[model samples]
Target: MKWFEIGLVVLTFASGIIWLLDRLFFAKARRERAGLLDDGRDPVVVDYAKAFFPILAVVLVLRSFVAEPFRIPSSSMMPTLLVGDFILVNKFAYGLRLPINNRKVVGIGLPERGDVVVFRPPAYPDQDWIKRVVGLPGDHIAYRDNVLYVNGEASAYQTIGQYVGKGRGEEMTGATLLSENLGGDGRHEVLEIESPLFASHGAGEWTVPEGEYFVMGDNRDRSDDSRFWGTLPESQLRGKAFLVWMNFDGAAGGVDFGRIGTRL
Candidate 1:
């Protein structure tokens, strides 16, 4: 479990113990000693628990089951999501899962193609990764010559122009931009560098296993994704990113107000 989650659990447990002790033992003692100078009605621990318990519970519920905020750390999801974008992920969008452990307790829906999802890669369980879903379970996916083929149907994309990266994204300059249309899902922007396919280029065809998903980054050539690691397990999925609440691009300026409140 994460340290933050452990801290939350500690807070919740401590608060509950304080409340129960006050109700069962301290309150009766205070009532019996009402005539004494120290009645123990306003103990410091009880006051602190009363002040923070509800707030902590609400935050835990919201972050664990409702919505959680995450900051993009890399250029893997560029164009659609930037390096400094602070995004909100819907925790219950895929299903309701317990925090830290990530064991699902409620079934809501499953991820669809073209959906931007956050999951822990099987190779690296401690790290969190965000990518676009390209293939679902039992689907045939291929990436050859910078083209994606899903179930024998080649993906259609329109070349936009040479990608002009901005701010920290400037490092990705010279890449090509393409407006990719994932039929029935919607359209999104992707970036690809012009380079000859070599060994370790992360190109291949795979039939996704059951309860697994194939994910790739918007920055095709630069992303180390399922193309490199392998299909993501359904259990490792964290949530679906839906909105960009803030962007702090230190490389560009300090803060970019234009990207605030952008929906995914």
Candidate 2:
């Protein structure tokens, strides 16, 4: 769990407990001592609780059940999501899961192909990873010769042009940009690096098991994804990324105001 989340949970519980205890045992005495039994309020601990508890509770609810913001840390997602983009993930889009534990208590929907999702990799549970869903349960997924195949049908894509990356995206400069239609979902852009650091072999073929998803980065060959760590467990899913609210490209020296409010 994130340290900030842990802190919020702790503050919420502590303030709530202080308020409850004061109301049950010390409120009347404190009020009487203040010389106005009917109108006076408990001063210190109770005041702190009253002021902070509600605010903390509201934040926890909104962040845990509605939507949460996450910062993109790497170029794995490339043109679709940049290194510094601050994105909002729809927490309840797929299902409502408990914070920290990430156990889904409500099943609202399932993941669809081409959906950008955030999840905890089974190989590294503490680290949050984001990728595009390529195969759903029972689907056959494969990658060969820089192309994707789903259930014997090759993915259709339109070559847009050579990607001219900037800032931290500089490394992807010579890559090919393709608008790939992953079927079911509308087309999205992806980068195909000519010379990949890691090559996909026969092991790239995978039959997605029930309650699992095969995910890949839009930056194709450069990503360490399902092709490397295997399918992601549905239970470890966080949410679907929908929008980019802010961006600060350190390699580019500063923030790019134009990227702010850009939809993902």
Candidate 3:
């Protein structure tokens, strides 16, 4: 039951191989016995396709349950993550669960504030989203005038400087860079666009209910995350994003060799 995806892949590959072998070897003999000329063309293409299916399926399983690859589509994570950065998520770090269903059959651990995580969008469950955990279950969270307050304790933010725009996204240009501290555990940079004027501002205090978490993007202005939708359920968590293996931005040209092997 747990290996359902793997099973399906294996079955499909086996069936294809049998069909290909039968057509390649036995078909000629049968055709000749019936006084027909054989073309002698081996249907290796079918076998190749069949083999590919299992390989793809294995990769899918590894990505979903183990580590998954993700591209920084937007500047939401900004300085910590770039528009073309390719990152890897630690799938089993939170817990091992069946992909798609997202039911946590194994409880390895829970998410803590300040951890960068990937989860299905609370508003749109079909979409996978990445954000930094701001509030855990039962914590009060609020954002006003671009400052974040958790449980009445304001997170420390020091003005670093202006963020220099790079790449093609409008979200990356003309933003303020600040070093944000999540209660001394970690320090990371976040971007706040000066022009936008904080669209989700003036929100009242949000008390995260049990079994849920409040999240936000590092690029404070451009992300559509927990601030707009809601808190992410524990079940919807995909994994903890921890590494960048490769980066490819077509507009910026080929692979980003410098970004490769960087830890998140």
Candidate 4:
């Protein structure tokens, strides 16, 4: 994905430069020679640049600052966000950032508890991972007996029956579903596998460091999140996820239109 971002920035800049250069230096010559044997067409490269520059620039601006699309690749988020769900992340929800390096140019908002966010993991900066923000900077975070506690206050969980997932998420069926209220972030559903016996993987108390955040997945027992990798750095924050644009799981199922447009 880092490569993709780099390539996009390069392509957009190259196309824009080509188009601008032609306008300043080559366009007048081409127009002056319009009556020649040539079809009066701009050079092939210039023609392409003129046609694609606007489109590329628009996409770059939107993806870099307004919103960006990301597809869920694993079942870690479970019933809340299915595998193969194409989601729209609000890129500027946290701040305005440069495209490739993701350096913030203007700060906007901070990740709130319970908001689903996409970020580059500390262990793998090139990759993006999405999870729920559970603890903010300087907050006391703990996970014990499959329960999440923030600043010594336990989140409320109400039984929501068994999870019946679809497409690639079908394997997660029969897991216990519950509605969790993260005090400040509102309510969301989570899945816990009862039959397998819940084993707390990273059960311990941790104080979120300054300029970092603690995140976790809705599928409590299966997520590789802050519990395993430590707090997420503020600089690696990408955006807050807000919508599911599409879903396509090639394993036994294809597109699931029902998931499209789902608000996270």
Candidate with top lDDT is: 4
Off by over 4 Å in 4: 36-39, 195-197
The lDDT-based order of candidates, best leading, equals 4, 1, 2, 3
Clashes of each: 0, 0, 1, 0
Every model's Cα RMSD, please?
Answer: 1.7, 2.4, 5.3, 1.8
**Better model by TM-score: candidate 2 vs candidate 4:** 4
lDDT of 2 at 52: 97
- Please list all clashing residue pairs in model 4, or write none if there are none: none
Poorly placed runs, candidate 2 (over 4 Å): 36-43, 196-203
Q: Per-model C-alpha lDDT, please?
A: 0.89, 0.87, 0.78, 0.89
- Cα deviation of 223, candidate 4, in Å: 0.7
- Candidate 3's residue-wise lDDT over 59-175, tens digit each? 767866888777777777777887788888998999998764777788788898888998877567666678999999999998977888988988899998877765555446567
Model 1, total clashes: 0
lDDT of 2 by residue, 92-181 (tens): 989998877888899999988989999989878888889999999999998988889999899998999999998888989989999998
Greater lDDT among 1 and 3 belongs to: 1
Candidate order, TM-score descending: 1, 4, 2, 3
Specify the poorest-scoring 10-residue window by lDDT in model 4: 193-202
